[model samples]
Target chain A: MTEAQEKNIPDVSSDFEPKIVAFCCHYCSYAAADLAGSMRLDYPTNIKILKIPCTGKVDVLYLLRAFEDGADGVIVAGCEEGTCHFINGNIKAKKKVKYTKKILDDIGLGGDRLEMYNLSAAMGQKFADLAKEMTERIKKLGPSPVNSGA
Target chain B: MIVGEQKPIEEISKMIAEYKTVLVMGCNTCIAVCHAGGEKEVGILASALRIKNKVEGREQNIEEASMERQCEREFVDELADKIKEADCVLSLACGVGPQTIVEFYPDTIVLPGINTTFYGMPKEQGFFVEFCGGCGNCVLDMTAGICPIVRCSKSMLNGPCGGSQEGRCEVNKDIDCGWQLIHDRLKAQGKLDFMDEILPPKDWSPARHGGPRKMVREDLKIDEKPEDEIEGITKEGEK
Candidate 1:
């Protein structure tokens, strides 16, 4: 940290901790998370993973509720294209995520807070990389405005 | 069924901005089936409105209620008590629901949350196509059950318009030429001879051109006196 920049950091920002929610599909992204753990790969601890049958099961309501409940960011992780165990669950999820992004933008949460990522069960390193990437993006964006005190 | 869609959230929010207490009323019948205004949709909208209010730092109270059919008086009566508590009612039913609520509660402000697009059935899941014009005339027998008044872009009665190209509508490439569909249907039934028959000009008096239409059945009308009042003398004679 630069000496001048480090000295001016507000106490609130120094203590600011982002809360991220991940909706992971059981057949792919969830298993990938498991693989990441088995490999002892490091990922941000702020991310809370919720295991779902498929990313298609992630309702727009659920994503909205996460933000309403003070989530700083949300990630819907599903199987890669053409490899969804449920035929097209991941494909459907991508559409839902795109739709939810519009809603977020409409409601002033800035859309960037929600994203959809796809990975295979064997991509442990990719999962770790996404976790760190999402965390940094959210940290730069700061806490969700939806969670800001009214 | 009546097909309608929810108004954009921005539009709805702007409507209820001045009101502190807003009630979102949903209809369980037509709008529900169309995925527009239903119980679940009401909840979603109510939440969205609350979130919008929070983001804007506006103190607002939003409530939700759903009725079986918003067009009927009895079903609308169910919201009587709740209606009194609200400053404005945001009706999520088709256009009829808001009108019904307005008639029942003339003093209250009732807002429309949907634009009633058409009287149609679900062509497929999440898709609706207009099929009936309610022109107060029935000519399905002559057209093999197709109503050209609704299906045809030009409402052509006799035959396909020359503008039709390859069985597709000239106006919209995605739309099938309504006359082409009629021709295929009539051909399948071996009723191609009907194609040569000339149809008379349609009488549009029963349509909206005659202003709002009302159908009254004399047999269905009740007498001025109740059944008990009329039958009282007969019951005494029997006794």
Candidate 2:
């Protein structure tokens, strides 16, 4: 945690809704989210999914923009390692997400607010579970500290 | 190419703490190629600053702009209007970029957002190695292309020092012995005889010891400050 965020961790309300931004890769996590919808799997509606051609296209700029724009949490969803649509898009994305996490940590937003998860098209259950897990995690972390200033 | 890395966010934030409006400038050339200061990096740094300001409760007006090259006068001139409006310019270019900006807009406050690291090339993705020391002398032909000045820890010109062991430098085993590399390359090219020449000591005067150096080509001169207004131009051969 940065000095800016060391002041205090305020208690979140019982009905706090986290604004989660999910950058889902088209070949895998997007398909997983679609299948999750088709299977009638109940997940947090707070996860706003934005589809991209591949996770490699996810730049550090995109991740920072999410927090700057009031996202309580950010998720980078890509294909399972070594199973990328563009050979190594997920690998690049994984590294980028890790780098962005450090940047987020530097800004006192706490790296916990950002995460990267690998998924496959068939694993709808995993998608729903990860979303739930992320939502719960963010709920514990409360709203992003950046939002406090806004 | 000149490589650089961005400074810590805290340091950068502190630099602009006194200013309200900032123009985040970037160059799309060498620094960009090394993933330091480019257009994409401009966005990243600008966004990070915005986030930091918001998180720290600082009301700042930050804008971002990138040029083809910040080392050039024409490109640096294009950002004049933006530089004029901002309280200061945060440059995401190598050291030369900020200096160039100051040379042109003397009144504008310019700060370096990246530290100029070295003259090197990337060995692989996300990996870079220092290749040249820019010592103002060319000894590559005799050294079989391996730069003893930079590749060698001691910058030895003759041969490897006693610290060299197993084809590695004593400074670090990860670093290959520059002389050893030169030996192997020379042997392969049937130029091993050059190693036995026992070359004389290098002329340090031509290097940095001679102070700042400048080169001018008479034929390349396009600007006119009046041929007789040769205050700084030194006569080469009186031609």
Candidate 3:
């Protein structure tokens, strides 16, 4: 495996730290991430979490802005399917993610850089695992095209 | 209300190429309600045009302004000073506004920044459906208030034509069959018998067939003053 790929693995020591923006729904994913921290679970500190009232509140424009502002990758963490506290908020988030993926692909950013993950508030460990997984995935993809110049 | 959308960015950019100073005009009437040519849209379009022009390395002086109603002569007349400063005007209003600008400023180049669609009503937050043809005839009483002329795929007065299948139009599966909706609505209201009456061939002359139509009211007429007499008149007297 390449040095970059090896650096991406969870718990593996390396100097590389991917800048990730996690848009967590307040009802579920935000609480889960907090729980993971309280549980003393070790996860990459590279991710910056932005808590929103609902996942549906994350607009496509926000996703594009994140990338434009030098986020290597973006992960929208919402409530598990059919479990959104705000009714169909998570479903709407999923639709926005799908739409944003298409737009990212069109703009030559590679849609895989953005992802939508669902987890209940109780799944604290899973949230950490997702963070590790996405960070490593983004590490392998290298810095975002927008950030490459800087 | 008239529904319209802004012309493509490239097209608008090309139209304003020759002019060093351009005014982006918006209409705050029907197009505004439909969320097409409103003040907000004017700002968005202006920003986009400015950015696109800058990116293309062709810098032009562009200004933004909007009026309450562009189709009215009085409202358009208010833009005399702004129009005088601008070499060209890019009207964000529907077709009528651009024509009105042309009528007012014969020497100024009037360009349309929007493609006028049709008279429509807001179906939902962001969706507008064409609902009127401006046929100069009122047939809503007979059609249960549904305008088949505008909503129907074929504009058939007596329809649910052979192409209608499963309550949808054959041309577009997404479109609900206008006749099917009309029939169901009329049946629910116990007015299905009205369908049996054949609609007469609509008179096209009242709409577009005849030369331009006009409505004149003698009561609304203002007596023209002789040039010598008007020299003594003030702004208050004109009203």
Candidate 4:
């Protein structure tokens, strides 16, 4: 497969440190990420966390803006379904992620660059795992064409 | 309101590729109301373009500004200084706004950031339904306020054609049959009798068919010269 074709999966190599923007919900994902930090889980350090009131607040425009602002990959970390503190915030975020994925695919950025993850605030290990997984995945994808040549 | 949608980012990026400096212009009127082109959209497009250009290592300098209205020459005049600094403009307004910009600054290339959709009204937030064709004829009186010319997928004035089933159009089950709506509305208002008035075919001359449309209201005209002209006249008088 061509480099572009093969770049869709996680490539855990030493030379890649993908820039990731994680839009974490305050009630769950943010706490989980914090817990992960306290636990000393050694995840990739490329993930930048932006805490939001709820996952539903992650608008599609914001996701696109993240990519536009040089983020190689984006993750909307919300509460697990049915466990959301804000009723349906996670569900709404899931829908937005799906919509954004379609948009990304259509725009030649590839849909896999954007992802949605769900975890409870106590699931610190999951948060760390997610961070590492996303970082590796994006590293495999190579630099976003939007940031590659630069 | 005229509803429009922004063109895809890739398409917009390609359109402005030749220019090193670009002004992303947004209209705050109809396009804004429709969530197509507005201050928010301008910022979004500007950021997208900047990132895309940066990724390509093209060194494009893009800036964003929004105007109250792009369709009017007076409103567009505010862009003079900003436009002068850019090699091209990416207009996020409806088709009318871009044309207005072109009229004022003939030398600059004005690119359309959005696809001009249709003359429509918002059905609800984020959704719009075409309601008028600007046909220059008032047929809504007979059809009970719903415009078949625009609402009907076929633009059939005397329709509900063979494609209408139950009360919906065959083209899309989601769409209500235009004539069905008209019939129901008229029936409820006791104006069903008007449907038999045998309305004649519409005259299209007043629309685009008759060379662009214009409105000259002698009553609204002021005898005094415009402000710009008055300023020039004052300078001449002082000299």
Query: Candidate 3 chain A: minimum summed lDDT over ten consecutive residues — where?
Result: A4-13
Native contacts present in each candidate (fraction): 0.37, 0.76, 0.00, 0.44
lDDT of 3 by residue, B1-102 (tens): 899987776678788998888989999998889766878777656655554454355657778889999998688778777877999999999999988777
Candidate 4 matches the true fold with a TM-score of 0.85
Please provide, for model 4 over A67-146, each residue's C-alpha lDDT reduced to its tens digit, 9 standing for 90 to 100. 98778999999998998888999999998899778767765677899999999999999999999899878987877777
Runs in model 2 deviating more than 4 A are A1-7, B224-239
Report the candidate with higher lDDT, 3 versus 4: 4
Greater lDDT among 2 and 4 belongs to 2
Candidate 1 residue-wise lDDT, B34-128, digit = tens? 98899978877787777667767788899999999999878988888898799999999998898877776777799999989998999898779
Better of 2 and 4 by TM-score: 2
Judged by TM-score, which candidate is best? 2
Task: Give the lDDT of residue B8 in candidate 4.
Answer: 86
Ranking by DockQ: 2, 1, 4, 3
Q: Report the Cα interface RMSD of each model, rounded to 1 decimal.
A: 1.8, 1.5, 6.7, 3.0
Model 1 alpha-carbon miss at residue B26, Å: 1.5
Which of candidates 2 and 3 is the stronger one according to TM-score? Answer: 2
Scored by lDDT, model 4 comes in at: 0.84
Which sections of candidate 1 miss by over 4 Å?
A1-14, B218-239
Per-residue C-alpha lDDT of model 3 across residues A41-99, encoded as one tens digit per residue: 98888889999999999977677667757788999999998888888998988988997
Q: If scored against the real structure, what TM-score would every candidate get?
A: 0.88, 0.93, 0.64, 0.85
How accurate locally, in lDDT, is each candidate? Answer: 0.86, 0.89, 0.81, 0.84
